[model samples]
Target: MSSPIFTTPDEVEAAFYAALAHADLDRMMAIWSEDDEVVCVHPGSIRLIGLVAIRESWRQLFASGARITVSATHPVRWSNLMTAVHTVHQHVHVEGDDRLHPPIIATNVFARGALGWKMVMHHASPAPDMDNLHSNDSPHIIH
Candidate 1:
């Protein structure tokens, strides 16, 4: 079956996290652009470039049979006409794992092509330890 043409970068990002949680490699790859310049960086791992390398890496990971739950928050987005960039704080949980892992900082870049908005790059890294993720000096109300 042909993959859905994602209409927005936000949709692609949503699908990306859903795929990650389910270990759906095909769904994950579908969100990525079909360009030779596409890139992905798994935490603590070397960068993987192009569709072939990225697919192989994901295939290996999904083979482990581990389910990962990803929760992303604190998004910062930038966009012009053809490209968009989104950065967010990521919290990941492994099924059956007791210990909590540090949060990840992720950046996702997307470009509008004939197939609509497709992700061109995803880079994730460990976030720095902070005393609190919430601000103590500011009001908690959303404006």
Candidate 2:
């Protein structure tokens, strides 16, 4: 069966995580655009550009045979007619592990094409502690 056409960036993002949680390679790739400009940065790993590199990177990761539970929260988004940018706090729980991992900050970019909204870039990095994240709430000077 073929993948469903994602009509919105939200749909694409949802499918991306669902595929990841299941280690479904084909399904994950379906959410990404086929453009050579597409990019993905997996946490601390080097950036993967183009479909071939990205696919191979994911393929290697999925080979580990561990399921990852990804939950997206605290979303901040910006969109126009053709492009959209979404930033969210990503919480990951590895199946069978009890330790809590720090949240990750992720940015997903999507573009509209003939097929519909497809993700062009996904960049994720470790997020700072909540106190550090809120430290800049006001302008203060160190004595």
Candidate 3:
């Protein structure tokens, strides 16, 4: 089996979500680095360490047939020669669901290696309901 070379962090991120939307486990796992310490934390779940754990979690999720489509936005990024870290708000929608779920805040970390950029970590959790933010009169503070 051949893995595609990802030229940049952006490309890896795009493919990550695309794989999730398509429920393709093979494509999803391809975005990750095969070595070093890898980790993933899904919303409301225990932290998953190593490729085996991460792969199983995603496989189970895809097996459930949710067909989730995610739109990642509001990214804050930091990068250097060998690694990159990015935080984005992910709006996930199930194929037939009409009720809007609050965006999930995700931190994606990537490393540059022989295979180009590959994701090393992905942590996603529920964000506060954004609808309520617009109705408040008090100053919204972020730290």
Cα deviation of 61 in candidate 1 (Å)? Answer: 1.0
lDDT per residue as tens, model 1, 1-143: 79889998999999999999999999999999999999999988999999999999999989999999999999999999899999999998999997899899999999999989999999999885565536466554558
- Clash number for every model? 0, 0, 0
Q: Name the lDDT value of residue 50 in candidate 2.
A: 98
Full-model lDDT for every candidate: 0.92, 0.93, 0.93
RMSD of each: 5.9, 3.8, 2.8
User: Model 2 over residues 20-136: C-alpha lDDT tens digits?
Assistant: 999999998999998989999999989989999999988998999989989999999999999999999999999999999999999999999998999999999998666875777
**Cα lDDT of model 3 by residue, 41-142, tens digit:** 999899999999999999999999888999999999999989999999999899989999888999999999987999999999998767898898878886
How far off is residue 36 in model 1, in Å?
Answer: 0.4
**TM-score of every prediction relative to native:** 0.89, 0.89, 0.89
Residue 18 accuracy (lDDT) in model 1:
94
Candidates in descending lDDT order: 3, 2, 1
Residue 2 local lDDT, model 3: 95
Error of 2 at 32 (Å): 0.7
Can you list the residue pairs that collide in candidate 2? none
True lDDT of residue 25, candidate 3: 94
